[model samples]
Target: MEIFWRIFDTLILAGGFVYIFIRYGIPFFDNRKKGIELSLKKAAEYEKEAEKLYEQAMDVLKEVKSEVENIKKEALKETETERNNIIKDAETAAEKISGNYINQAKSEIDKQKKQLFDEALNMSFKFMQDIMQREMTSEVYGKINDSFLKLQEEAFDRRSNK
Candidate 1:
């Protein structure tokens, strides 16, 4: 009879616990499920925003890369232009210097030629005078002087007529 009563009491307690869990635990679990869903939705939104930022950064990086290439091309072109100008200027300077050197050389050669001609003429004149002095006596010189004076007078008269 006692064992029967204990079994009955245990059954009663088990029934009460099942009723409480069904009434309270179900609502608690449902609330927790809704909270988890809300958190997952927020996480998805944050992930989308992060993806959009990454795309924008990539676009900016591409533009910056293209701009850097353009700048490098311009710099290379400018450098090439400067190099050509330097070469042209150097060539012009070299030509001018070469022309000046040639002119100086020609002037020096002409000056030497003139000096040689003058010296040769002076030498010839001295030789002729020495020969004339050695061959001619004083009587012959006096006769040559008289003849030269006559020839000068005749040349002067002919010039006055013309």
Candidate 2:
């Protein structure tokens, strides 16, 4: 039993020395541990930096989207305003044209009416003069005056009867 225990202790010590040399490097175990720990710390710091950059990029993208939306809305409003202005201008122009046409038509009608009245007055005067000249013999002229007086007297009598 003692011999078996002595061999086990020797094997355990040799295995421990081999494991330490492989894990911590052959030169200095503490130096190897510090180098590994520093490398891990640097890796963690770089990961955190990459995460911060990603967040900043996402924020910038969101801001750009918001600005684009605002520009689109402004453009739509401008287009609508322009459309309304054009419609109003067209309506005003149409109304003005219609009013001018109405005035011109009224003027033409008044001018035609005046011309018709003048022609009628001229015809009436010419016919009256022709009739007077045809009846200008002294005896016929005296008889026309007597007949006109008699006609007036009959009209006055008819109105009194009514």
Candidate 3:
């Protein structure tokens, strides 16, 4: 009979302990599970946002790279245009200088030719007067002088007209 009472007391004590665990411990564990689930959901949302931000960053990088290439091409084109303009301007200046030099040279040659012709004509007239004074009589000399003067006047008129 003592052994049977001992066994019955042990059974009651075990049943009370099991009731307390079911009432309190199960709710505590259930709340902890709900919190863990909420934390996991929030972590998943954060991961998705991170991926979206990464994609946007990559897109922006691509646009910036494209713009840089376009700027380089535009700079090269502008440089080429400026170089061509400089070359064209230099050529035009060279042509203008050459033309001026040519015109000046022609003018100088024409002036020299006219001065040389005038000197030759004056020397020939002096030579003819010396010959006539040495070789002719006064009557022949006077007639030759009048004829020579008329010819000289006609030549001078022709030269002035030209």
Candidate 4:
């Protein structure tokens, strides 16, 4: 009789515990599982979105890099062009300066030649006067004076015509 009562009490207790677990624990665990599944879904969506953003950023980076390279090349070309222009301008200026110097030198040479010719003419005239004073008579002097006057008039007329 004691064993039978003990077995009956144990069965009753076990049945109540099972009924309570089925009524409450299973639903709670199911709801918890649903929440965990929803969290996993959201994490997957976020991962996909992050990958898309990364790809877009990479594309943008590529374009920016290409643009930077193009800008660098254009700047180098402009710099080279400007350098060439400067060299050409410098060469032109040097040529102009040299041309001016050559013209000035030619003019100086012509002026010096005119001055030397004038000096020689004056020296010859003075030498002729000294010789005439030392060696010539009055009649010879008169004749020489007449011829000299005629030569002087002819020279003056030719100079005026030129």
TM-score of each: 0.66, 0.55, 0.55, 0.62
As for TM-score, the candidate ahead, 3 or 4, is 4
Alpha-carbon RMSD, each predicted model: 4.3, 9.8, 7.8, 6.3
lDDT of 4 by residue, 1-162 (tens): 999999999998998888888998889899999999999999999999999999999999999999999999999999999999999999999999999999999999999999999999999999998987898999997998999999999999999999
Q: Give me the overall lDDT of model 4.
A: 0.95
- Cα lDDT of model 2 overall? 0.92
lDDT of 2 by residue, 1-162 (tens): 999999999989988988887776665757778889998999999999999999998999999999999999999999999999999999999999999999999999999999999999999999999988886899987898899999999999999999
Model 3: colliding residue pairs: none
Candidates in order have lDDT scores of: 0.95, 0.92, 0.94, 0.95
lDDT tens string, model 1, 57-141? 9999999999999999999999999999999999999999999999999999999999999999999999999999899999999
User: Which 10 residues in a row give candidate 1 its minimum summed lDDT?
Assistant: 17-26
- Give the Cα-based TM-score of candidate 3 against the true structure: 0.55
Instruction: Output the lDDT of residue 117, model 1.
Output: 97
Error of 1 at 90 (Å): 0.9
Looking at model 2, how many pairs of residues clash? Answer: 0
Identify the runs in model 2 with alpha carbons over 4 angstroms from their true place: 1-47, 134-136
